[model samples]
Target: MRSTTPRIDVVPAPTPAASLVFTTVLTHGPLTRIEISRRTALSSAAVTKAVRPLMAAGYLVEDADEEARPSLGRPATLVRVDGGRALFIGVKVTGDEIIAVLADLCCRIRVARHLPVTDRDPGAVLASISGLVQELLTEAEGFGVEVRGLGLAVSGDVDRAAGVVRYSPFLDWRDVPLVELASTVTGLPVTVDNDVRALTVAEQWFGAGAGISDFALVTVGAGIGCGLVVHGKVVSGAHGVAGEIGHLPIDPLGPPCHCGNTGCVEAIAGDAAIIRRVREATGAPVTDSAGALELAHQGDPGAREAYTRAGEAIGRAIGAVVNVLGPQRVIISGEGLAAYDLFAEQIRDAFTASAFGTAAQCDVMTRPLPFEEWARGAAATAIQSFIGIDTY
Candidate 1:
């Protein structure tokens, strides 16, 4: 069911209609021509025209369903994306580690590798990344597939249009042209995006936000990050920083944030903030996130209180997003969910208490995603880039 490398067909670069038809099938197939027309708002003739080239290129296949007949005396066959046409690589870079996955055209993971970084310098991280990509390339050789693209996802201010990392606090990098560097090193087209935004894209295409016109994914952990999709597009803002609920001023008297702002949502709800509060309130020399979660689970009053406050802050931030955008859902995720039980009640309470009117009716759900899922998001970004559908 899984292979490190896959046999890739020589799929021609798709035209605009071809791209649309292929995406429609990949998301909502095996669909008939009539159904594809209804979903994409193209005429049946246009759908047929678009699908023909994709089918010839081996990117789409028609499944025979002779038993199923249309009213016009012709049997309608179902069309679906061919998952083996190409391969891509997606990598999520965290402060201390890199998680990379080799994925097929369908964005399914074929192989994954993780590397730890002892240094945050850009050169050191790039070297580690190159080694990992080379390993995956060898894996690709076994399948006789060419890896078409690479997606690199990192946190902090990212200028995705320019394929640059403007400022990555976790990586201690500034103005690094990541896409060009990675492309040169790996010999493939590359896309660089904000980690949370890349994750949102994956969610929009295949996860909880699928078919929804509007939604938000809020990540709580070392950093509190939000990714917003509205009116069927992820809002990257004019300066490439939108949906940054973490910097919203929620409490004037709250602790200072690394962004040099006092009382920001992230200042009150981020991991470091919670750990600092726990240490001060409990005098328990807790040094890291695991220790903080352990103390909270053990019923330590200070640890519990810290999480309670963080939950309140995060809830209010989500409330702000809902009040403004009115998304149909808000997905809560990230490594921080390991301690979700400690603060779940507080999050619910604060959200209900502060959300304005019908905004409270917006569904809020938490789905835990591991690091590999984030890497898959990176792969999704690469797919978007390859298809020339990248809006950001």
Candidate 2:
């Protein structure tokens, strides 16, 4: 008798140029073969050869238009990834909840699910993730496509190569082999990455940072996290801690951070920090970000003061990033944008005061991305894995 347990079939050698072709279409898709060759620096024959298998495998498709022509006096048919091809599972684990999605190969969310977590322990979180993935896997069965991989996006220092969660402060987890555990439980290949970097990958491929070679994604929420993409690649420092701008020391007398530093960006700008400062200033039991934002919107002096300081701290952090990397743009994101109106002016003022010369010219903008988007970013990581691209 055959074993009853369902299992994920192991993928054979994924195409070599699959990564180059996939990445080309991911960042600059709907392009002709000629354009793909030009962008990826692959020869035209190579692009066609690389794309043929993907098209045959249903992962990519050519546009219907047959009349489009390149400037070189040649008819060029555009090619794009099929968003409905193979499905994928992406999960973003936070302190309070798990956000999961069934995304396509092109990283579009075909379905989404969320589960609240009262427990931060690894076992509990893994149980939650397994249940969610099972649900998505059942959903994919309806679409008649395999769920290729599972991507988990977590906050803090993560070694993507080692597939370990080194230290996640919010979850109180240390040295957890999350990828191995999840893959075992779900019977699917897994890719785990830092939440901010995962978000950066999605942005680089599909969102605001698309086509920009150098840009920064600064997340302000429970913690301050920065993801830097320079020269067309996200920088993961040699030690797996490249853009820890949250821990960058800017003030010596500021509140103490969990990292044992004072006046770090997170210490001043994180949600907990803002709440602590608000309670101290107003003598009110402001319990959460919503309460603080309400007080500030109500013209409460103390609440307004807390946000003002937070804005200044964040702006200074952005200035520091600009001073060092000189990115073409800095994107301010996270759940913190709900309070952006309260501190937008202060952020601009502090950034202007702190930025030096040409660095100040770097575009600073706010973009609100929901947790689903972050999870979709996790799916992006799996796509990278499938294409055999380098990942952190």
Candidate 3:
């Protein structure tokens, strides 16, 4: 039986200056009003005005004075987001599992839960989502805070403005009204976006991408997903499908992708693809990515060779991103990193070979973010919507 959907109380107004001020405070606080003004480049008066409503609503709280503010002629008080002001829920639906987190206003995870996914149909996935959301909602009750919103992160071409999953190749979904359906069942405002894009939000604010204006986040797991942030903003292209690096056609003779394209990066390096290649190379009855990895770990030449090729494909994809966007950094992450040792050399070699000129100098690094962090990224999206900065 479906549980009753509890209603969330606050609906934040999406004001431009207030949103900017609030986010600046979020990423670089507890800081003084003067610091906020300087960082945001808003006039002191504008900062004060923007801080008013937020303070009044108990979202921004003034910290104790660290030093006197003689220059700004204001109280020497540090300001930081009151994380306990409200709470949110973030859900990351992978092909194998559903991960949910209950987070505070600051996007800190207070509680988390994981559930196996036995079915991939929209109805079954929604039911699984509802169950996890209900669990998180119950957990939120212990904090004595209102749960403000829910964020849903799935892989594929997602239309954030429309709250629709235009197409999720991993789940074989098309034109799913995810936000509306999720809101109907959860009774909270929902923000649905591409999983990689959602993770990029957390990366921009809290991970390696912090303070960097331009970078790319590439996830290598069940799928090869890329999220691009250009000029400090997550690029969503005019058609809601920017940064589809996973589908870059590196080889016309390569494997076919679920997107009906051949030789796409994902078709070569994605987890399923790697597993398939491993099975073909070793003639082993590998059923899952874990089994495939185990074979490679056991010193099976064929299995290791499969991962090496996957790395090469990924490196070429990264090279393309650098040549086109010229980002400051490229961060590689995802569950696939569990096998990084097997492919690290190939990735660097191929990237070096394919990158052109100064683009080759782009910093390339790997980060192992658990599925929970992806769920946290989902929560960050909910926080973004609550603060009216859903531009991501």
- The residue ranges of model 3 lying beyond 4 angstroms of the native Cα positions read 1-13, 67-75, 390-392
Score residue 318 of candidate 2 by CA lDDT.
91
Q: Model 2, 1-392: lDDT tens per residue?
A: 11123343322235656676778786788887888888888898888788877777777788745566656664667799887777889999999989999998789899999999999999999999999998998999899998888889999999999999999999999999998888778888789999999999999988899989999999999999999999989889998888998898888999899988788989999999999999999999999999999899999999999999999999999998999999999999999999999999999999988999999999999999999999999998887886678744
Find the candidate with the highest lDDT and give its number. 3
- What's the CA error at residue 278 for candidate 3, in Å? 1.4
TM-score, prediction 1: 0.94
- Runs in model 1 with CA error above 4 Å? 1-16, 66-75
lDDT of each: 0.87, 0.88, 0.89
lDDT per residue (tens digit) for residues 262-360 in model 3: 999999999889999999999999989899999999999999999999999999999999999999999999999999999999999999999999999
> Residue 21: error of model 1 in Å?
2.1
Error of 2 at 82 (Å): 1.8
Please report the TM-score between candidate 2 and the true structure.
0.94
Supply every candidate's count of residue pairs whose N, Cα or C atoms clash at under 3 angstroms.
0, 0, 0
Instruction: Tell me how far the alpha carbon of residue 204 in candidate 3 is from the true structure, in angstroms, after superposition.
Output: 0.8
